[model samples]
Target chain A: MTDSFSGQEKSNAWSIKRRLTILYVVSAFGILLISTVFLYWVLTTRLAKEDGQFLAAKINLLREILAEAPNNKEVLQEEVEWETAPFRLAKYYARILDSRGRVLIETGKMDTVAPSYIFPRPARLGQTPSHAAMRKSTNGHSLLVMTALARVGDSRGQTRILQLALDISHEDELISDYRSRLLLVLLAGILLSAGVGVFVAGRGLKPIEKITRTVQHISAHQLHRRLGQSDWPLELNELAGAFDGMLDRLEDSFNRLTQFSADLAHELRTPINNLIGETEVALSRERVVEDYREVLESSLEEYSRLSHVIESLLFLARAESSEARIEKKLFDPRKEIEDVIEFYEAMAEERGVTVTYRKASAAAGSGFVNADPTFFRQALSNLISNALRYTRQGGKIEIGVEWGTDGGLNISVADNGMGIEPEHLGRIFDRFYRADSSRSENKPGSGLGLAIVKSIMQLHHGSASVKSEPGKGTKVTLSFPD
Target chain B: MRILIVEDESKAAAYLKKGLSENGFVVDTSSEGDGGLALMEKNEYALVILDVMLPGRDGWDILSEIRRRGIATPVLFLTAKDSVQDRVKGLDLGADDYLVKPFAFSELLARVRTVLRRGPVRQPDILNIADLEIDLLRHRAARQGTKLDLTPKEFSLLALLARRCGEVVSRALIADQVWGMNFDSDTNVVDVAVRRLRRKVDDPFEKKLIQTVRGVGYMIEND
Candidate 1:
């Protein structure tokens, strides 16, 4: 059973660790992905704005030159000089269109490029100097184009549309490079987080592993070992404590079992040794018939003793195993006690012990109880016999039946005899346990009478308890359910 | 009468065989189940004394085989398993009687006799114990030609006690036999009845026939 349980626990531990690692990786990757997308968007938007601004400034310079020139040809000449400036490193193009939509001045680079719809045209002649920026492909190169409607030389009626373009392929390439690098970094971050997650999960489960190891070291033989609860975390400390408690119970039962077996062997050995020694001695000689008869009779006594032990042991075993069925029926408790008292009357008389029965005034008329009469009698008889065994000659043994304080039936056998010590009262019901060990030598019992009584009470779903004080008296109570 | 003993423990088997043989029985012993079964199949025995735990095959299986073959031979189960369920199971399997181990040899003999008496072959109607004679068919008992007045229960109890003469019969057994009671009554009804029976069976006679075995029960034996 433990093997299967541990196997299940191992799988559970593995799954927990795996799940923790997966959870960590998934959340980390999600955050990283969102932040990367946001950063890329911000950088690209800024770059596009800067490009638009640069194109607008270049367009302004062209507008100024066009306004200053006397004719369209001189305007072209000034444009060429402006384009030749050392600061203007990027390839540039420009075109000027009148209000009639006729191109008046065009730069040398503009003639080579196609006339594409890079930006929207102004609705009217001047409409607050409308400006727009767009992208166009020229000669297999991507360019940013900015168009504006400017009033030349401050003439309110005169207006010209200025179109400026700048090659921005380098900026596009830089943005793409940053995007790929961001993706690589995101992958690395996921891997690193997964590794750290696994490490942390393993550390978190270290205490459980330690507990399992400690428990595994404790075999059936070494049940005293415990998982040190002080070293464990709070949750696992509870688990360790539970485990230690279970071990305590196991050790207690194991010790009891070991002791029971040893006691059983000892009890059997005495009678067997007597039988064997007497028989062997008798067989060693050619005895007369009467001598043989005497030997047989002596051996029969030993056999009878052995038989009693076996019978009591079997009864206890059956009771413990739940094989002894108690046929519960409604019967008179007082009548039952009276019957037991009557049964022991002959023996009590022979032993010179006075036995009496008492019924409480509160329970005098009420007699019915749901219990197994035979088992109740058996329990009562056992107690009465014990009382007879311990009570001095001419002493009194009172058997009483009454309603218990808690409302159930209570039958108590109190003997004013050689009482048991207070310490021995608790364990008197243990199998093969003797209250007065010295007095046991003279008592002809299997030392199982009280144990059998206890078992009988248990079979009836009741409880048996004893109270005793030295030099006073002993009282045993069998409390039954209502 | 012939009997077959199937037991694993050699010492127990030997003692059983010796005791039964001394009691005028032709006893055969087997220590294994298969051999015991084979002996049962071949021989006509008065009864079979079987132990529950045996090598080669268990007592339950052997008994089942015997019954399955349509043989109604009586079987008395002798076992160390004294639980009520074991006894019920043995009886359910067609065993005539069940005796727990570490039992008194006298008890075993009495049970064996009871089982054998249940067979189809009828025992003699007359039972003799020294000078006392019990006529079962006529329901009469006499001591030295003097007829003794006895009730039906007293006669049956005396007959049972006389059959297993010189052996102690517990009050529980007497209650079971005479009163047909399976559960003890907590009262000394059996002892009281026996005391009444003893007055009639022994008080008038010079030589007492019924004797009390203290702490046990009663025995009808001549001194």
Candidate 2:
């Protein structure tokens, strides 16, 4: 519908500018025609009525003079001749017709009589005058003729009709002049509207063209390119701002992913080298049975390390690429937390770290919420591992699960250990980033525990935050939205 | 003989230690560039295996440093970077050879031996085990002084086995030494080559020197 109305295709024939211009021209021309027709009808009818009255009065005067001098034909002719100049100056043609409708007295150079004209009978005797008005031509000239009957001096038997006409050539020329002026005004309006329409169309399309140019210049390698804020409208500024923010996130994420892959390969190279190198060395040596056993045992340990690294790296890869499918199900938060803490009790016992778990009574309407059990367990395990690694030999670790006032569940893992510094807290979840580089050797980690934990929490649509000081204990909290 | 290993990782260092120690070469390692240059300047090493990336500097820098210091130690780069540009760059920087990581240790050992063979040791190019003899210089093989007709691949396989007598040479090592690049061939090229060489070198003999250890590769040993 819009396309048909706008004539979208044929710009040369009906552009938006031309269409708007045409509308203005057509409406103005129609209005001018109606007004000119109404004005011309009103003015021409009034002038004709007035001319008819003046002619009627003149006819009455000539009748009175003719009645006073009953047989004076030459004097009547002289009186009529004196009136002829005034009538002619007023563009009127007067002629006297006898009672039989024959032309008796003719004025000016009209030598032959014109054809008779007709009119409908009037309703009243004198209120609506019964007259015949028509266009007639005699010889080479044309004239309008109006005829009215008049009684000679109260004698109904003797009636005379006077015919009058006023030439309309000057009125026709005046109407033509008015029409030409109306056409000029209509043309001016059309041209002005057309120019305005083109200007508006250009202004409206400018921002759209800028968006196109910005998008065209972007590529995979150049994801950093963003639509910068410039001289744009309000909505366009907001759109460009949102686009730049999204690009900032994408570039940061892609760079981190690439760096992580490289680091994974670099980290795994060490273990694979140990496995292959150890096996080759043992097989190449001419050793006794006992020596062979020793070589086999050590090689098995190296293989296990390789397998462990590969498993952890695979988990990290799945998390990084978002390939890990999360199955959300309703599970009791209290039971899940207690079970996890109990499972880690044996490992904690070895280091004399007492692990205690406490679950607060489920809050109102908070018996359970939706969560991925596997990811939840994985995230909890990482927190436990970190707590145990940093805790003192006889320190206590608290694992508590509770329902928050808001529609969420909070699980906190707090331990009495050397807490992290404010500076390191932000980067603790980075791949291969350890709180203390020296502690890495002691704990013997792949350095992907916190990174994997962060990813798992993200998958579960939850968040993990940590609070720590230089010397006090640390608290790690996981919040799952209800 | 002296051998140099330029590896960035410590675990790989330990792995190479046991293998090269048993191969009769006193192996020394550098985990970075400065250490590797320091070791090369202080010692007269026969072979050097370097990695591309290190802490202080990279292997290419060590290679250039070694050359700048006029140390003509044969360096074989062992790294995970396997692009052509890396190879060309390493060779251009005075590296003797390049081997990508995730490599079979025996292949590494073989390259080390090959590089060392052309070094100062310059041992006799002829290898003899029991009655079987391989003349590396002439590229010929025979059993009990009887010259045998061997194909180009068979002669090389027989020669490699004869050189590493009494020790198990892995199939991956054999493939690497022969094919150069690590390509998986479906056919049992090693076994077929060994079988064909047995016909040429042991068929007309009274004693069989080419013996196969059940699950292991073929061995040329003394009776």
Candidate 3:
């Protein structure tokens, strides 16, 4: 993977950004080296030209001086001899040669320097005291020889020329040393930039590595673990906040699911215990026909209770899964409630609890509503049963159904019993939540009744609410949308 | 009255023995089908309570073997596998009664009395235990020519115990037998009724017939 990422052919071995930066510095140093070499070439060439010019002028003066003498050749030779003396000038080396390109003046020093030299040829040389630079070789010594032709004593006599040469080996050595130092500086700069690039890349990617490790250690059960958003860099802080928020939601849902399952098991235990107890009792004894019949009856009752609890649990589960299909049909809510209340009338009468119903005058004609009759009846029955259980023997219980303002339906059950306290009123619909006395002492019921009612109401696209005072009474209202 | 217990578990069988012997019934036990059948073939028992899930030979097999051999001892099947089909099947297999497991001892005693009684038409109208005699058909109780006016609950409670005179009966069994399914465990119905019955049946007498076993149950024993 690293090879693939780094192997873009067009990219320089160094990154484009780094190459550009280094290139700027290295190219400037290269230009500086080239300029220094050019400056040295120009300066040395000009100095050599000036030295040749000065020697030519000196040769003209000597020619005039020697021509004025009584013996020209001997005088010229004597003058050259004096000028070429070793103590004359250390930087200058001069020689005089005849038109035949031979040594004309016998300067003892010049004799060794230019025993055989290529003075400018007579015809090829310029006419009016011209100058030419040439190379000389004598007795295994090499020199940069400059020669100039000139006239003597205002007349062209003997056609003598002046020659000068200088050794430039020391200047060449100094320029070579400077070039080596520049090369070393450029190589060091490249190595240092590569080290800086690596450090910067590692520092920039550190937070990304930290985020990866933190996420890997997190598990569903450990929702309390957080990314500690404050510790994250500004670039990643938003992501950490969102992660913590999602964990909060997940924790809440997990807690609710566990509690719901526990409540379901707790509710089912009552019927299961009863069933096991009664069946065990019946099986452990020998009985005649009459006694067997009584045991069978109790056993059957327990079986029915078990089936009821199981079916409710199944319905609740299906509702949660969104698989509970309501068998929609038109049903008379008022008549249905009335019939249920009438069915339970005998029990209420036996207990001296009065059962009543108050149906709206228009309800008879407008009682039809689309709902699952089975679930509807179950919801209504649970409400009535809860009412009957709570109310004292002489208390009154009433059921009502009417049409609401938005063409919706409303149903309610009111009981003049020991009403629920304010604190418990809101939580009554939560599964397995029961008010203190009615749940613990007076009567026992699977506290899933209200939860089942709420689920059924949800299936019907309705809402359920409760209104009550501690001692006065309680009214449960259910409303369905049209 | 003679009774037979067919159970696989020895501890349960011993407990049954202790209880039935204390209640005054002549109790015989068998841990297997053939042994129970051999006992049944040699003696005529008033009742036989059999357990369904047994090793070697099951309760149904023993019941079938007894019936096939023409021993018409009244049989009750007590089993832990208490499904509806098991109940129907036991009844069809000629079991006189069926009870599930973990039953109260008093219920077992009640059922034993019920099964031990002679056929409906030939049942003895009067049941007697020592000096105490009960006219069950008339619902009357008397001891040594003294008439006892017992309430309905008291009469039924005493009659059930008197019928199984020497057996130890646990309170759970008594509660199940006396109140049946109508009473909840939270109520003191069984103890209250037993107290009332004890007053009428044993309190006034010098020789106490009804004895209480600590942490166990009540028993009708000789002084």
Candidate 4:
């Protein structure tokens, strides 16, 4: 029904300016029509009252003369007839009748122009007979005819009928002229309303247009730009703030992505340069079998490093994607961490780092995790090796499980190794972020060890945090939800 | 033993053929999926090494076809997708085993041997390698009746390499089978453990049983 009522897309989907203008015009038109009709009615009523009173007054005067002096001809001709009178009433007719219905006096041509039959019958002999009517004269003039009975002042003590008529064709012409002028005023009012509506609506929606222009200028390269909310009204503040917040988040992620790609290229280039340079040098001249064997082994090592980087990259990518499927199972986290400690035992022993697992004295019981066992172990292994890498001889590493503040489980690995510098503490978990880059150049990590651990924790809907005191120890915790 | 490797990359197929031939298996190679399926149809082989992404009719189709025809040749899927879903899908389609690509050739060799050795494997309680005796039931080892002192994990590592006897076992396999560490780590944990085991198991004897196959893995072989 709304579609049919609208009739067309342009009207139904009118712009705010057009819609407001049309509404203004329609309301103005309605008000003008009603008031114009009311004024016309009031005017019509007043004119009719005046005409009736004029005829009554003339009859009353004529009645007076007939009773006091029935033969007063000059007075009747001047006042009652109004034919040659100097009054502003240009056209009128009067007639008098005797008690037995005989025409006593009448203005010349009163019978021809307004016959007696056209007037209402006079009231029966006593009451002042009063009636007024509109009729076309015999000569095509509009007339208002009225009749009344008046008692004479003479000794006869009889009642006589008096008839009078007035022409109103000039008044009708004046009313029609008033109506056409009113119509012109009404049309002008509607147009002015539409104009005012357009101006007002445009002023109200100017801010939204400004917003569109600002938004159009922003691209991926200009994500840092924001729709500052301070200039907007209260109603638009929320929209502006939300837009700025989205841009903030977008800019942050885009920066991280850009940094990640650069890091990836650098990490990959390191090993490829080595492989190419070493292979090219080896093939520059013939070498002994042992030399060739050594070169090939070195190339194989580079290949393994390249493969490891790819593997870690893939794992990080998969863990970040929402669709990376992790098959969770219920298991004791303490037991899982213990297995990784055992796995890293021999390596730690060679470095004289005693790695062990123990329940935190503050812990209530063995805490379990609904997590993928493979990912959990990998995370723990990375942390253990990171600890082992920095630990000096006789350094100690401890793995502990305890209840978190929020009733979840917290698994921590604390090592009395070389603690990290305070400045590098924050970004240790970023991919390819190395703390002591030159020192860790020949280290066992792929530079993604901690990043992978962080990714794994994220996949479990958990968090990983680190606290370190240089020269004392460093502690890394994985907090899992209850 | 006989095996067929269906792979698209020419270098991968050639190296796989070389490695399997060196391991004493009569190996055949095909670069297309349909051709590999036809080869298996006309010939009887002990096992099929199938690569998942092929030019025509992929590895899954070929494996399903081989199984549909009632041929009992065990198939091991070799593909690059390491997702759990793809692994389950391959196994669900009658693949005997699954090995992800960029695989250590030794791991492939180990899987191939396992697939061909279908059905039950019966072994005596003891495995003898020269004078060294490993008692699988007791979790003890001795050379010429002198019991070697070893930790439980060390004993298990010995048992894993001993089970494969003369075969070269990759470090990843050793880590997984012995310590249950499935992810790749750049640490020398496995190598360190092997060295510790060799100190007790091989250093005092005139003959060494354990050997490091340089950047590949470890093996305990006696001549």
Candidate 5:
């Protein structure tokens, strides 16, 4: 009754729902983190590219002006210092160097912030002069610096080196502002995802928890409780169905055991009570030796009957038990049938009941069964005797071996006498079940004959069934698998 | 012949002693394992009936000890355990035979006789119970010098009862010995067979040789 786990028990630190939630959170966080980092990289790369193009445009403007007026240093300086908007994308610093790397013309603050030597090497002439590098100035200002070869003198004359710098401190502050905002969003996303993961996982596993609660409330006496098969999901429906199937088998076995015990006690109480009463009365006075002998003999007979019941019960138990090892060999069913018939021939002749054995002409195969010969004999013997008991004088009892429709061998014993009533036929194979108890009292049997027959059939992995018509006859057939 | 019974249950030991004594055996009973062993050491018995479950010095230990001392006395085990493993264990320990408890007295007696009659069976060609004679070799039965017509099964049945002439043979034993059916078939088949045999072997004469012992079994004797 203690429904303890049969194997090694596992001690888990976390519940299944918790584990599912953690798995969901970890995988989701991984995907979100990758995308967030990629977004930041794209934004920063775009801002840097724009700054480089802006520096290139400023270098091109210097190239155009110097080509028209070669010594106009003031004009180049004024062009570098001019700003149309009060709030620019970035502040620019430009310096023009001659062929000897001398500063011919420069912005006022260009030397202090750029210090000319910190610029990139000039590009080839007639090129776009793009691709600037970013550097931090000595005074803690962020700058984009670039150099290019520009034509000076008339229409692409001498080449001049133009160094330009863009102060990106304002852009850096804007990108930093975006980075912190993104961090806040990521943190919020993590918290939101974990919360949703917990909810979703709990919702998905709610059925399993319901099953556990139902199972926990079910003890031995509460076997009637069931996990209703309809409410479960598709995957768990199979599990629930199987569990209910097992419960059905268990309940059936439990009911049978209860009925069997009650019947056994009732059956045993009669003979035992008779023995006690018979002995007590016999010893009531100084009885004669003959009387005492008769009582003792009767008591021994009672004991023998009780002993037979016990033996039959044990045989039934052993056959049904998992450890019952039946030794099977390939043997002809005809031979065992012959032997059983021979044993019953005397009884048959005594009753004037004609018993016949036949092998149906339509039967196929060699008619040999791979089964325990003793059990076969016992099964045939019980069936034959039962047939003989039911048959009247001048009646016919026929036994035959034939191939059933499904290819299994069928051994049936049919009699032409008073048949059983239909209402009593359903439980005919139950232990100690007699249709007409009053009539069976006159006859001799422990009423376990058919039960033993049924048990033996089960051990052979076969089945026993009965077909009877109230006034016609009863035919019991045993089917063995092919 | 002498026999020693070591059984802790007093009622079982007492009835066994009485039965064996009545059957003309010099029986000795012991309620303890050590006492039984001491008796076995002091007395030379033809057979020892030992119960496997005892108060002290289990029957197996006593048996092994006796065999260890090189004693060749036959030992028959009586126990409530009817499992095949237990039976094989008893035999493997050199016991002569085994019988489960709640056993019929006739079965125990028959087993005891068979155990005592070990080593080269004595098959008599002809058995005489007063005027009835059973020819074992020829498979024939005759009374008053007239041949009794019986089938082979009937002949074997008569022979079995004649061989164990005066002792009561149980119905289960008869069914097993004759039909090779080992279960206690709760039926009157044995009674019917015996009745048919009685018609052929006993009905014709004034004296009945095959006698039913009334709820026990059959025995062939001139009584």
Candidate 6:
């Protein structure tokens, strides 16, 4: 358990559960300690006051009895009888002295063990009663002593010093017992709070544990599974949402990768099958010299097809992986577009399609852009070729260059021919996606034209977009950053 | 037999023309889909060999267009796309057969024969005239009950002429059917092959069954 706890600490210094439990226990302990101390103090002060009151009350009763006496002798007799009374079960001692320090009256209880030093000496008249020091009697009983000045006889000018002592051993025992019991209750309360802290902390962190379990069950193949966000706490809900968002992106990329492989397999299979079928059939029969020559020529065609596919695939791979380098240079956009148009003019004329170039009036002034001329021209060439392929005889294809509203360059190719449907426009830039498979079947295209164009724009930190209406026309735009 | 080849690739089209011509069929070639479609609409053909990828129009569109016009011409799809879906689509679009590109001349010729044999204008099982008998199914040719040892091309050449015994088949037609060549190459390949074929089929027999109409073509006739 220690090993596991240390490992967990390495990951997160203290887990939430442990931290919460510690916080709860520490706070509870602090509050419990303060209250226990307060209660103990109140109890001790009240007990001490009660003990002092009891001693004072006893002294007042003795003074009253002395005042009612007719003479000093009777007072002495009364004091002696009071000390020996059956109601006075507690240990007690008392004495009365005249102004000259001569003992006037004394309790018989003091004859065996009297604490003379505990009585105040030379007490001032009319002084408030004061507690004297504690003393032990001969029987080893602890006592509290008090002293006061009083008038014991009927004479107004006469004063006496009164000293009293009471046994307090039993009260001390009760207070000690209460103190020990209070301390035990305080300790038990702290321990119970710690136990409660752990339980509350565990309940509070249950959502995190649930999230961890759900996350643990997710693997690459099960990326589609999402963490439950509904029943979680607010903070944990946000975490689950973020995690689910990440999975969404992961699953999207995974699906794209799978689709790419399937498309690649299909694209590669055609040429391979052609090569196999052709060679197998050729070798099946013994043919004349001219027939053998024809077979080799056909085989070379299939080989070229294979090489073309590989080259295109390699270029795509490099571009997608960011391994393809772009050498940007300041050049005239108009000249580049014209050069591309010139290159495709022959093929366009062969198809009886007219190609034209247009420039916005503002673009003619400063139409230069910093870009890789070769790749830029290639991107334009792909668009032009696509337009030419879709355009019909006598159809007009226009290439236009202009300054975009965002201070960038926008080069567009528009053709008045068969336009793409809106549904296909979104995926037109995806690799191996063709707008119309039936129409593209006859065209000599690898179906990577738009994808390559998109990649080129990406390498140049630009974007490509298309707008078209079926049977009307199609326009493709390439935007470059300023 | 007269066949139409609609292929966008010039070289492949030339090869197909040569191979079909040398096999004793008259072959017409078009490098674009629209041109092939126009040609097919103007004339009747025994078979139409179409490349799926074309410039102006595609093979599927052309096939559908012809089929829509109630033209029951058998179409054979010749393409570089050999995917099962592509093949299935071609067949679904009323194509009689499908052959991928970079194909052997012999295989194309055989498929062309198979298509032609199944055509509406069927030929007899055995073409017989002037004691010369050609077995179309067995690919065998014999004169007067004596078996003839002939190469495949030679036998095809004999069978072609014997089928049209009294008609003049042009050199262009023979070249297109036998060698699958679209344009005449400046060589005596066809003449040389024919001379060798005549040596085995005619030179061995008393009466000559092969004769050349000067500047026109060759024919087998009982004179």
The per-model lDDT (C-alpha) reads 0.78, 0.68, 0.68, 0.84, 0.84, 0.75
* Models, CA RMSD each: 8.5, 20.3, 22.5, 9.3, 5.0, 24.2
Model 2 TM-score is 0.44
When 2 and 3 are scored with TM-score, the better candidate is 2
Roughly what TM-score does model 3 have, to 2 decimal places?
Answer: 0.36
What lDDT tens digits, residue by residue, belong to model 5 across residues A1-482? 33356323665558777887788778777877888889999999999888888887877787888787777766765686554123266777877888679987777767777898788777778786558888887688998888888887775356788888888999899989988988887788778878988999889998988887777787778788788789899988998998888888788778777888887998899789989999999989998999999999999888988888888888888787775767778777887888788788888989999888887874443676767888888888888888888889988889888887766788899998789999889878888888777775534777788999999989888899999997789999998776
- Tens digits of per-residue lDDT, candidate 2, A1-482, equal 35665533655555545465556556656776677667767876775676556655665566665456635777666655555656443455566667677877656644453444522222222232434244545543335455555556555557666555555445556656866776676667556655666666667667978897887788779998988888768888998898889889888878877877776776677667766887798789698897777766666545545544555566666665634677888887666666556445545766789888766564522557578876676677678877887888899998877775567777889998889989989878878777886655434566777877888778777888899977778999887777
Candidate 6 structure, TM-score to reference: 0.43
Per-model chain B TM-scores are 0.70, 0.74, 0.61, 0.96, 0.96, 0.54
lDDT per residue as tens, model 6, A180-264: 9878877887788889889998998888888988988989899989986788899999999999998998998788778778877
Per-residue lDDT for A406-473 in model 1, tens only? 66788899999889988887778988888777766535678888888888888878899988877778
Docking class of 3: incorrect
TM-score of chain B of 3: 0.61
Clash count (model 2, backbone only)? 0
Better of 1 and 3 by DockQ: 1
True contacts kept of each: 0.07, 0.00, 0.00, 0.60, 0.40, 0.00
> Residue-wise lDDT of candidate 3 within A190-282, one digit each (tens)?
565556655655576678679878977878778778887788888789888888887887886677667767766766676667667876887
Candidate 1 residue lDDT tens string, B43-117: 999899999999878999999998998888899998878777888899999999988777767678778877776
Per TM-score, the best of the predicted structures is 5
Q: Give DockQ: model 2.
A: 0.01
Judging by TM-score, tell me the better candidate of 2 and 4.
Answer: 4
Model 6, docking class: incorrect
lDDT of 4 at A396: 96
Model 2 Cα lDDT, one tens digit per residue, B1-223: 8877878789998789778899787888777788878888788887888888888777777788888888887888887754556778988998878777656565577667666666487556888777777888898887778888876667777877777776667654565455331222111345655666677788888788778743334667775
The true-versus-predicted C-alpha distance at residue A395 of model 1, in Å, is: 4.0
Model 6, position A110, has a per-residue lDDT of: 75
List candidate 4 stretches off by more than 4 Å.
A1-205, A234-239, A361-363
Candidate 3 residue B82 C-alpha distance from true site, Å? 22
Whole-model lDDT, model 6 = 0.75
